[model samples]
Structure formats: structure tokens, C-alpha cells
Target: MDLSCFKAYDLRGRVPDQLNPTLAEKIGRAYVAITGAKKVIVGYDIRLSSPEITEALSSGLMAAGADVYDIGLCGTEQVYFATSHYGMDGGIMVTASHNPKDHNGMKMVGPESRPISSDNGLNDIRDRVLEPFANAPEQGRYETLEVMSAYVDHLLGYIDAGSLKPMTIVCNAGNGGAGLVIDELEQHLPFEFVKVHHQPDGHFPNGVPNPILPENRTATADAVIEHGAAMGIAWDGDYDRCFFFDENGRFIEGYYVVGLLADQFLRKTGGGKVIHDPRLTWNTLDLVKAAGGKAIESKTGHAFIKQRMRDEDAVYGGEMSAHHYFRDFAYCDSGMIPWLLIAERLCQSGQTLSSLIDARIEAYPASGEINRTINDPPKVIAAIEAKYSVGAKSVSFVDGLSVEFDNWRFNLRMSNTEPVVRLNVESRADKALMEAKTEELLQEMDRLNKN
Candidate 1:
């Protein structure tokens, strides 16, 4: 009822206070009213609070005269697949998606798995739920089905590994929903794999499986080195993003992976358009163009990226953060595609992961993306633009504030769910200039943060 639980992209908050069953029930009733769906599929993650919330949500849906199909414990993507595969009118997945354990959220999908962000339909749902708790409409029937295997078959359809050469690999599911997907894929894939922390432990005894953090990546990197494997792969809580470490235990930047995937997709589809986030994407754009494909740049975030992909009919898309989407997969981002393509490439070229991505890292040196907390994000963007936008070759305000010099560019965008502004700077293999410019921008941003 507080309504703050309705975030910019999804319904997420610090649990009970911001999100609870009372509100969850209201949300379910409101969702049915807004989407006008008679049947809705529901799925949830391994979070301790998920089961309780799912049941509460079901109660609300049934009260709203909608039948509920309980998909049971599953990852977010599985929910997406089920939503579309089952021909349900809509679906909801209870997850916070790599957020801290105490935090939980829900991601909803409509027919064709269309996302329901705040701007889309979440705002309306929020408004309806805030009005009052409504009476029960009907006792909707409930059904259960194990969807993991069906999801596996769906993912496998995107790529073939039967012709791939044997290579040792390491996978770390990071005590999240990743293991559920990886476990099924391992049995069918031909590669000799070494799995690290593949079990789904909600306690996250090994720490969250977020590869973006150095601490969370230790196990994956160690496994790659210890097993002397070709490479290692890691995923976030919902397994929607995948990151990698090369054979020597060196963590590869998400930018390079974007380039690798761009190249692979181009080869497979023969130069269709590709979408990428501007923060760490020039390399991907360059590769796409060289492969005779057009490149389209979207602002960060899966919601925006997928929208652009649908608009442009892009064959593939990637974010430096390791999210990959395929046209063949309904233009939705998947955490399961990257490693499969890597394995396919390794088999095709008989090359190690290092050899494949080495040239890309060297060709496009990056400063690695950084985030800065600021009191006034718009004021900071104004200050940076005032100081650096002069005489710049070009500037674009597509998602946030992006300024481009002849050889380097950076975008400063505020986080939708936090007070921090993310700064992503990239130069043409000029590490020194990138460092200097990064410091200058950070100093400017810090000056604004103080005011």
C-alpha cells in the first residue's frame, strides 16, 4: 500500500516494510484487472521469502477471478519461457535478481513475455492496489509442472555443440538459480566441464554469484586456474547475466565478451543489426560493422535494450554487464546464451578462450565502469557537460548524458533505484588518457556531490 515498492523497472524493495503478502495480494488482484488475464503463471527463486510470497500472491489472483498455474521454484528466465510456452495471459516471478538476500521483488510478463515495468503497466497496478484490498472473485485452480527440462530444450535450440571440439571449462553457479540451468545443460553438452559451487544454496554460503564483484568471482577464477580449464563462466542470482575468466585465470571485461558475441552472431546470421549499451560498447559496434552488420546503441538496462531490439528487429544484443539477447529467443535477454556461444566458437576454431578474446582486449582498452554516489545527479551531469562538452565532436542525450570526443566518450546516467550515477569511460586503447579523464570526471562529480 505504501506504493514505493513499485520501482522504475520492477516491484522491488527491502521486503516486509516495502513488500509483503498484504501488498502482494493487492498486486495480484490489480494485475489481473489491468492485464485482463484469466490465467497467470507464477514462478519464484530460492530466496527464503519466495514461497510465502508466491502463496500470498496466488490467493490474491484467485480472489481476482484468475486461475493460477504454479510453476514452482525456478529462475526468472524459466518464468519468461513458461509465460510464453504455456500460452498464459501473464506470468510473475518472485525474485530480487542479485539484490541483497533480505531484499525481494517481482518481475511480471504478459502475453509473448512482454515486460511490465513501471512505465508499462506496473504504475497502474500500483495505483489499483493502493486504493483498497478487494473481495475474492473466484477460487482459481492451481497446477504445478517442472519446467527446467523444457527450458533446457528451448535454450539448446539456439546453438548446437555436437560439432564442437572437446575443451575443459569451469562453471560457477554462485549458490543461486544458475545451477538449475547449468546442471541440465552440462548433461547434454559435450565439453569436459569443471563445476564450482554448482549447488543452489539460498544462504549463499560462498557469497552471491555476481561476477561483477571481485570477491564473488574468486571461486570461478580459482576453478579455472585449478582445473587448468579453457575458461570459466559465472552468473548472477537469477542467472540472467554471465561473466567469464580466461584460461590463465584473468577476468575478462564484459566489453570484450560483447565483441566476441557480436562477431559470432554476425557470422551465424550474416550481418544483421546488433544492439549494445553505450557505456562499454564501441568495440562491439566496431565488430558488428566490420562483419557487415549495423550497430544500434541503447541506454543501459534490459528494459530499454529489449524495447530497442524489438523496434529495430535486431538479430542480437549485448551489454557490457554480460546480458545477451537473441532475436531467435523473442528479443529477451538471457544469461544462458553467452557461454554456449563461447563453447561453440571454441569448438569451431579449435582455439582457447584467451586466444579468441586477446586481440579484442588489446585493441580496445577500457577503464572498467565505475559508479559514483551523488546528492544531485542532474546537477553533476550539468557540471560535467559544462566542463567537457565544449568543442566535442558530438553529444547525445538518448538515455542519460553522453558526450563524445573524437577518440573517447563517456556517459553519466543516474541509477533508477539508487542515488548513484554510473560513469562508463572508454578510449581508443589509451589507458593513460582514460585514467586521466576518468579522474577529472570523478573529481568534477565529487565536487557536485558535496553540494
Candidate 2:
């Protein structure tokens, strides 16, 4: 009866109390009833409760006359890949991503792997869960689907494997599902992988696999330095988003990776549109333009970026948060594809990752997303916007308040789920100015929050 798992983009909540096999079954029925999906590809992550929940969900799907193709023990993107790769009617991934271990949720996609978010059929399905469900006269069949070979082939297709030479790379799976795919890919690639926390353990011994947190990054960084790796990569539990660390063991900001990927992808395609988030722009814009590609800004979030990629026919889309979407991959974000491309870049260029990123950092210094706990985020944002907009060369609100001047720019946006204000500031080739402006802005926000 508790459907609190439904969210703006996907379903996420504490398990059983908010999400259980009983509720998952009803949700399966509601999903089939609302979306009219005849063939649904279902996948689950490495969580203790995932198998049970997935079984109940499949039962409901079959009961609702929708055949189920279960892709067992996979990442969220695998569901996205299976849905579009097989031309299925829809797909659902049972994953809570980086949420606490006791929590579980689902991310759903309709035909062509388009997201089914709150504005779309997600809300409808949530409402339908409250209604009675009658089984169809003919129950749908259930079958196991083995999509790894095909999915791995698709991932490798994004890179020039022949150009990839021998190199040592560090990949920290954080005891999530990414290690499974890395094992599969290892057979084909020449790169030597120093695997850390590499296993699909639902128990999550090294914590919850979220590499974004500073504390969670130490293991990966330490391994990269200890092993003398070319670069290090880390992924969340479901492996939809991946984080990067250079050979020097410094965690590269995701914003820089966005620019690097845009450049790498654009070179292969000759010229194409690159979708990016507005929080940090100068570096991406510079690289995109130099690569002879057009840059389009989209509001942050996977659904928004994916939709924008589809609309613009973009070759690649990336967010500072580490979600990279590819046109060839049905406009879905993939943690696997980004790293493969980076490996290829390193192999072909014969340059260290830090050398490539350092130049760009010098060109555009950024405050890599600072978060502040505020009582009234909206009031603080509006107040900050009013004061900062006075002499700004340009101002816009594609996602939040973004103000630009000749030498410096900053973006202040409130978190959708919390009373936190996220701020990003950047300066043209001046880290000192960027730091100063960041400090000044933080001080102003603090001053406004008190008022």
C-alpha cells in the first residue's frame, strides 16, 4: 500500500516498508497496464533483496499478459541496452543506485528505451497500483535473456580497439556489478586492469559503491598510485555513472571528463552536436568548438539530457555528474562506454591522462560543485541571483541561475530533494580569480541564508 518509492525521475525508497515484493508485483501489473508493454526486459543489480523483488515483479508482468525477458545480475544500463537492443516494448531496472544498502528502487524505460518519468507514464503507473489488478486470460511467458555478449560488442564498437595498445589501468568496481562487465571486456582488450574491490557483492563490503564522495574515493586513488596505473575509473552500485582518477591519483572532476569525452567523440564523428549541462561550460564549449562540433546546453538530470540527445540527434551528451549518453547506444547513459573511449584516447595519443586534463584546467578553472546546507534554498538562490545579475554580461536559468561575466561565471541551483544549495564557479584561465569569486559567492550566499 505504500507507494512512496515513486519519485520525480525513478522509484527510490527504503526496502519492504516502502518497497517490497508485494508492492513490486502490483507495480509490474500497473506498468504493463499503463504502458501497454507486451515484452518487458527486466534486470536487477547486486542487492540482497533484488532477486526476490525481481521475481515478484516478473510474476506481475506475466500475470498482466506481458512476457518477461529477465536479464539477471546486470547494471541499470544493461536494462536500457536490452530494451532498445532487442526492440522490447519496455524495460525496468531494479536498483537503488548509490542509495543505502537497506533501500531498493526501479528505473523504467518505455519503447526505444525512452525514460518513463513522473511527467510521463510513471505517475500513471503509480496511481494504477492502487487499483485492483485482474489477471489476463492468457498469462505472458517468462524467459532468461543473455545479452552480455551483444551488449559488450556494442560497447566495444564505440572505440577503436585496434588502436588500443598495451597499458595498465585501474578500475575500482567498489564491489558492484561493473566488475562483471570489466571481466567480459578484459578478454578482448589489451589493457592490463588492476581490479580493486572487484566483485558483485550485494553486501557491499567497501561501502555502497558511490565514488562521488571524497571518503569513497581513497581506495581507488590509492590503488591507482600503488599500481602505477595510466588512469583509474570508479562506478556506483548500478554502474550508470562512472568517476575518473588520473595516473597521479588525483580525482579528475567530472566536468573535465565531459569536455574530454566530447572532444574524443567528436573526433570520431567528424562533427556533431554535444549536449552538456550549464553548471560548468567554458571548458566543454572550448573543446567542442575546437573539435568542429556544436554545443547545446540541457538542464541537468538523466531524463533531461537523454531527451535532449534524442531531440538534437547528438553524437554524445555528458553531464558534470558523470552520466554520459550516446546516440549509438539509443541515447541512454552508460558507465561502461565512457571508460572504453577514454582508454582508446590514451592508447592512441600516447599521452598521460593528467597531461591532457591539466591544459584544460589551466584554460578554465572551476569550483567543482560546492554544496551548502541552507534553511530556504529558493529564497537564497533568488536573492543571490538578484545581487549577482546587476553587472553580469549575461544571465540565464536553463537549470538554475547562471550568471556570466567576461572573466568569471557561476551557477547556483537548489537540490531537488534537499534544502541544499549547489554552487559552481569558473574563471577564464585564472584559478585565483575562480577561487576568489567562489569564496565571495559562498560568503554572499551565507549572508543571504542568515537573512
How many clashes in each structure? 1, 0
Error of 2 at 231 (Å): 0.7
Taken over the whole model, the C-alpha lDDT of each candidate is 0.84, 0.95
lDDT of 2 by residue, 1-451 (tens): 7788999999999988999999999999999999999999999999999999999999999999999999999999999999999999999999999999999999999999999999898999999999999999999999999999999999989988789899888999989999999999999999899999998898999899999989999998998999999999999999999999999999999999999999999999999999999999999999999999999999999899999998999999999999999999999999999999999999999999999999999999999999999998889988888898999999999998999999999999989888898999999999999999999999998998888
Candidate 1 Cα misplacement greater than 4 A, ranges = 133-138, 447-451
Work out the TM-score per prediction. 0.95, 0.99
Cα miss at 360, model 1 (Å)? 1.4
Top candidate by lDDT: 2
Global local distance difference test of model 1: 0.84
lDDT of 2 at 411: 92
For residues 1-451, write the lDDT of model 1, one tens digit per residue.
Answer: 4777788778788788988888888889899888888889999888888898999998888888889989887878888888888888999999888888877889998887888888889889888886765665466777787777878888887676576667788988888888777777878887787878888877878876677988887888888888899889888888878888989998999889988998988988888989998776678878998999999989888888888999999999898888898887667878888788888888888888898887776666777878887888888898888888899988788778888887788888888778989998888877788788889888888877887
